[model samples]
Target: MKEMCPNCKSNFAAKDINNINKNSIFIEKQCPSCNKWFCLNKTLTIIKIIGIFLLLITSLLNIFNIKSEYSPVFSSIGLVGILMAIIVTFFGKHETVK
Candidate 1:
């Protein structure tokens, strides 16, 4: 499914949205049709940030050779977080630019 522009109320594919900066989530996007700026909703932004943080923590644990019985649990959580962040990128709701 495509995302709807909050301003023009027009539907757009994920590829149609342009990020102000490819590497930064803090930037807003412009609607191709309306030319109005928008951004991912606060809830999704938080989820994405948390997911990235979890992944970073797990990566650090591995890099430091921290081994424990809960290692598998941490790894799984990290995997889930990665997946969640990716999902939020495409499916997250958009709001006016923050």
Candidate 2:
């Protein structure tokens, strides 16, 4: 599990627990935005997964033309939806809080 740093709010990826127990569950992560260290949280990972899944479903529905309406408007809407999903899925990373 990751926790966001209460100070700078930077996102730090946590490595699976190994032999090293730092006595603290968290590590100091450098914030790309503010250059400060903060705790990372596992919630971010969950959110990213859910967002991508929804994006994939919408994109597939658009690709197969599953809907009965195959009009130009429908096609355009589908294309736009797919594009938006891709963008959000790939680049919707949360920025470090400053």
Scored by TM-score, the top model is: 1
Per-residue lDDT for 1-98 in model 2, tens only? 44333555544444522222234433334544455544334354455445556556656666787664644555555556556545544454433323
Candidate RMSDs in Å, in order, are 2.8, 9.2
Clash number for every model?
0, 7
Compared with the true structure, what per-residue lDDT tens digits does model 1 show for residues 9-62? 898886887746546655577888878887788788889999999999997887
Error of 1 at 81 (Å): 1.0
Best by lDDT: 1
Query: Residue 79 deviation, candidate 1, in Å?
Result: 1.2
State candidate 2's TM-score. 0.33
**lDDT score, candidate 2, position 72:** 54
What are the lDDT figures for the candidates, one per model?
A: 0.82, 0.48
Please state the error at residue 65 of candidate 1 in Å. 1.6
Indicate the residue-level lDDT of 55 in model 2: 55
